[model samples]
Target: MTDVIIVGAGPVGLLLAGDLAQTGVDVTLLERRDGAISNLSRAFGVHARSLEQLDARGLADPLLPTGSAVGRLRLFQTVEVDLGALPSRFPYLLITPQYNVERLLLERARAAGVAIVHNAEVNGVDQDADGVTVHTTGGSHRAAYVVGTDGHRSAVRQALGLPFPGRSVLKSIMLADVKVAEEPAELLAVNGVGDAFAFMAPFGDGYYRIFAWDRDNPVPDDQPLELDELRQVVTRALGSDYGMHDPRWLSRFHSDERQAPEYRVGRVFLAGDAAHVHSPAGGQGMNTGLQDAANLSWKLAAVLRGAPDALLDTYQAERHPVGRSVLRSSGAIIRAAMIESAVGQALRGFAVRRALSVPKIRARITGQLSGIGYTYPAHRGEHALVGTRAADVALAGGERLYEALRDRRFVLIGDADLPGWEDRVRVAAPAEAGGPLILVRPDGYVGWAGRDGTGLPEALTRLAGAPSAHMAGHTAS
Candidate 1:
């Protein structure tokens, strides 16, 4: 039996697979689709925190060069507001198509020795105390753990009897990637109608991704989409019949802001759209999924490497609230952009403009959009900062905590000598640099940090399985 079996070879699944493989776990990823589709542009932005996660896997440099860095996001209405004051190292959104993101992730997963079985749909799954037995089109496979990263209609989630509770927004959105002769100069633009909106983003490939919604017109799932119908909607929203030639792809999607009741059930877990689905208003879907993988991957690794099974509980604790927060923010964005009543539009427009005027409010919203406002709660008996992600701080070892964590190992920072723990951990002195000595996890999160090393031994014991007999001798200088 494999250590883990991940359903869906999307970005989140591939990311988890890569992380697990890097940590020496035997992982298998199943995908319904054979290979990457060229015209898929479902998601087009990766936020700052996702970039850091990608960097951890040594995949960011090659992947980033394939997309554009969009620093300014312009929200269009009767009045336009620019989001430029966000406080993040990646202060802007990176505009790469979802397909490219998946491509890069697949490459990294392969390099990490993750076995991917494509066109292998998971039909059902049965989990017990020992392991999970996954039934797929090809055959049945057993795994110690199973993660569902499939899209909205997740087979794994359905088989597990998880509740996807949320309401559909009752609007039909038409998305098309087309080569246009006369494209707008703005990197991103959202034109507002009475209760509807149309957004366009130039992908630098002589193609533009156009999304237009018809307020009060919700198409049923089985309904057919006509190209002429989408063209008319585009013409009405743009106020001009701009030619859309050589259409690469066209799709109609209805927004459903649904989320699973629980992220984990028995040996089965869910992440990405399988766990939550929201309106693609702020391009938060992919970023949220990537963060979910980042959070769960290390925990899974820890469990496989002999940490307490209780570590698995933290995944839901950390990510459930995050999913809820995304739901609230994305719902607001959808309402503001698609609410039909003139008064509602005017009110939302006023509110957005007024909110943007406040620096703190703007920064908060921007930080949320960039996925920089997330921090997990620390364990009670551990250091006050043990479970929290280490902030980027310069170390005496001539590297930032985040930079040092790229190797996917645990690091201990203190003034004390940790000679006995040197084989399993890296010790760095914080006083020699401008910041505190911090213990960093391979996932680029801070595991512990303190000046006095009050709870250092206990924290290390918990994270590293058990403490050595020499732990008592590694006292602070």
Candidate 2:
């Protein structure tokens, strides 16, 4: 049996498979479509935290040049969240097509020796106490664990009979990829009027993505899209469509704010759209999924490699709340942007403008949107740095914190001792005073921190699984 089977070869599944494969886990990835990268990308913004995950895998540099960066998020005509002021190395959002992210992750997954089977649609899943059986179009595949990243209409989720309790928040949202006669005022141009909303971003390939919706023009998803209608919606919202023409593709879909009741059921798990979905207002969909993969891959690897099975439970504990938070935030932004009444629009505009005017409020919004402000509950008792995102701090030997995490092993920065656990942990230079002796997880979150390595072994056992046989030790700071 394969160690793990991942359904859906999108960003989330690819990232998880790549990470696991990189760490020598046997992983198989399945996708329904023929193994061709699609030009159609529903997601655009790559948030800072997700970028950090890419950076940890040494992918950030190669992907950064593929798209432009945008530092501000416009809530409406007047309110803008300035991401440039946010903390961390990547203070702004990267506006790249979802295809760029998918391509990069697929490359990494292949390089890591993950067996990817395309055109294999997953029809059902059955899991017993021991393992999982995935029913696909090709055949039945067995694995110790199965993960479903198969999108919002997840067959695996349905097979498990899990409840995805939520409703469609927005409908008939029009999308198109086309060439424009002229550029917009900003790299990322978005605005909404009382009856319509529109957003535009470029793929850096001489084409622009146009998203527009008319509140008054409710149409069926299968209704053929007319360029004139798209032009009218964009013009109504942004005052111009930049002479949009020569459409490459056009479609309409609805956005829902739903989440699976539980992220896990027995040996089968859900991540990305398979677990939760929300409005695309904040561009949080793909980023959230990528982060979910990052959060779950490490725990899954540990558990499969002889760690206590209880460690896998933390994946849902830490990520479910983040998914809920994203739903609330993105739903609020979309509802606010879609306000129709004149008075309601004015009130929302005033409220958002006033809220974003405060420095702290702006920073908070930036942090939330950028995914840097997220914190998991401290498994280790309260330390100032516990459950916090470990910054890419400079350490001795000209190395950086994130650089130390590249190998997917736990790093003991400024450690004291881990006699038999050297195989699973790396000892590095001490962090700054406030963050001395920090234990950074493979996913880049601070698992533990203190002035010394006291209580470190317990945390290690809980996180990295029981350490392997003694290898070698490095001098502690």
* Candidate number of the best TM-score: 2
Per-residue lDDT of 164 in model 1: 99
lDDT of each: 0.78, 0.88
TM-score of 2: 0.97
Per-candidate clash tally: 3, 0
Q: How do the predictions measure up, each by TM-score?
A: 0.92, 0.97
Model 2 lDDT tens row, 371-456? 99898997445577877888888877788888888888888788466777666678887445455688989999988887765677
Model 2 ranges off by over 4 Å: 431-435, 470-477
Model 1 residue 439 CA deviation in Å? 2.5
Q: Give the CA lDDT, 0 to 100, for residue 189 in model 2.
A: 86
C-alpha lDDT of residue 309 in model 1: 84
